[model samples]
Target: MTTLTRARTGPFAADYAALKAAAWLTPARERAWERLQEAASPSERRGNERWKYTDVRPLTSVPYRLAHAGALPGLAEVKKIAPWDDAWTTLTFVDGHFAPALSTEPTGRVAAGRLATATASVQSLLEARLAKVQAIDEEYFTLLNTAFLSDGAYVHVPDNAVEERAVHLLFIASPATSPRVAHPRTLVIAGKNSQSKFVESYVSLADSDQHFSNAVTEFFLDDGAQVEHYRILAENEKSHHIGNTRVHHMANSRFNSISFAIGPAIGRNDHHALIDGPGAETNLSGLYMTTNGQHMDNNISVNHEKPHGTSRQYYKGILAGKSRAVFSGIVVVKPGADKTFADQKDLNLLLSPGAEVDTKPSLEIFADDVKCFHGATAGHVDLDTLYYMRSRGIGLEAATQMLIRGFAAEVVERIKLPALARYVEGVTEKMLPEFRLEVPK
Candidate 1:
């Protein structure tokens, strides 16, 4: 991809100046701005294999108003959207601005979130981790996130601490009179031997407003640490979502993540986990379902830099109507990284003649002794199976929905948290009706 210039990053031009004028500017942000100026330009996307399947013009052409601390829904309404009450700690943001009134403080922790009123300890973690992450450095969106960075929720789990409850970082996109955008950032620092669960969700308060949510989340797992991560993207059909998630795993640490992309007119998310030390384990799974004219893209990768690392990647997609989706899963093992076991797979099902999907699952192993595998498949449901269900007196739509659920169950069932699983089930079930196949007579 060709590097972008100041005028080439079209969509953010209108708000770039405003973003730089903020009084809380930092040296890191200034450096981010410089990098963003040289980041990838969408104009050259079609020629790049990474961008060949998904067109990013929808995200690059629109002028956006900077999201501010404006009017927002009350706590009761937000609960209807998020619906998670048993969280160990809850930190909420509206249009990327912290909502202290709606957030809850953790009772028995050093500090849970970074608020303007954050404790000194929590503030220290934010300063150290936010702009210093170099794991998945220098992609276009990552730099844009830092260049326009604002207030964020920083979750810090101290060394050897066992966080009993999950941490919820909920971000809402409120309706706006004009096209608006926000850069929401979340950083989780799990100290050595500590354990915690993290949930990062994106939802819209308005049904069909034009809003762009550019969000970035990073996880720093120290040695022997364990972190369970869940990322959900369910926004209005008229909105757009572009996000980047980075995970840095040290020696003997473990990371398990499940991501769901079930919304947005146009969406793109990049998830990368770097196994920087030996004995680290990473498990990643994702599901994306699209209907109507929506477009969604998921780019996931696991990089092993040391020996004895293990990683698993499984992703699936269901496409219907005229919708489009792209899935790219990759595993890379560096030289001398022996005994690294990595496997990745991507599967997609098309339910309509107009539906389309592009999936690529690959492995790059520099170590000859490493065990690596990758596979990808895209196809429609079996006709005989559908007919057999109908022969058993099940209606066509009901039979199709059942099959769709069965196909997606593998990834959904991966959620270890019961409460979050139920919530995710509710969200995924609501969108099943949209995936019914266009059965021809």
Candidate 2:
């Protein structure tokens, strides 16, 4: 593994000593901490090529104390924020500590709990596959999360098992006296010929609270496995949110992911996938809505390491006020990976004059017999559409909101979880009023 010697030792380093002593440190975790300590800081902060558009300096500079054991005093606040109305089994974590008080027991063909409570069989599965998809040298935030990794959702489905309801993992950040940070690490394993769905949500108790959330999740799909994953980011507007999700696909497996970024003053969500075997298929989709002084960035990359693999990426963003948004999509086809098919597209709707978006869609193809394409677009709502709606007795605000929602619906509709999809649509509708229709002159 490569190391970054120039990486700045940030706030995480300050709490490293206290954090390691409290948790039952394993050799793997110790190695990860060393990697983070040695790795260079986020290159994007230095105005580097990968993170040039989105500025995260303000977030990285804050000194946030890491959350420890018994952080959640009660479950009253968590129940209100987490979606527990349905029958889905929920594994709740408060301030990165698994809260059994607010979670439901896994009762089906699935095993779900904190890593500590994992059965021997489940532990074996996790030990064999936990960090295989995400490398420690790739990103600063990823390495940071792995170093402090303690209790998080660990889910496993046996071969040929099919789950009826989606498993929900809720990571709720409570108000802290001072600035605080939480690293929520989740590992999901789908056995061969198995199928399941998962919904992972990050939310704050109130909008006034200020905190930072650094989360990382990994998904392993064996041959003939199918998994649908949803990541919902609804943190407080005063908080900073950074998350990384890595997925590995085996032969004849399918993985679909939908990420919604609707909160946080400064947010960055990354979705990366590695197609390790032939006949694997993946669909990566995202929706980001930012308003006021918010800044949101969505980064996605899909690597095809085997022949006959297919992947697609679709990301859309809505920006209002002086908010800034970024969409970077990179698809790489390795040499001799013939018969690979990939497509990438990004669309942005700017609702204010000061709103900005930087989009980059690139495809690297080393094989001649591959079909790859990428495209991006950023602009305001169509004046003609607004005019037509006004002529039909619809008000300007309503008209603009409709158009913006329509743009985001394209991606939201693809989510396989019905309840989650509906909830997201409702949230998007409520967010529409934040933007106004200014007919372009």
Cα displacement (angstroms), candidate 1, residue 130, comes to 2.3
Q: Give the Cα-based TM-score of candidate 2 against the true structure.
A: 0.94
Model 1 residue runs over 4 Å out of place are 1-7, 10-14, 20-25, 115-124, 135-137
In lDDT terms, how accurate is model 2? Answer: 0.82
Per residue, candidate 1 scores C-alpha lDDT tens digits across 1-441 of: 444433365566666666643334356677777877766664355456666777777777877768888986898888676647655478889998888777888765535765344566556566677666554347677787777765677778889988778888999998888898888888888999998888889988888799999888988899999998899898889898888888888999999988888889989878888888899999988899999999999888888989999999888999999999988888889998899999998899889888988888888889868888888888887889999999999988999999898998999998877877887889878888878888555
TM, every model: 0.94, 0.94
Error (Å) of candidate 2 at residue 261 is 1.1
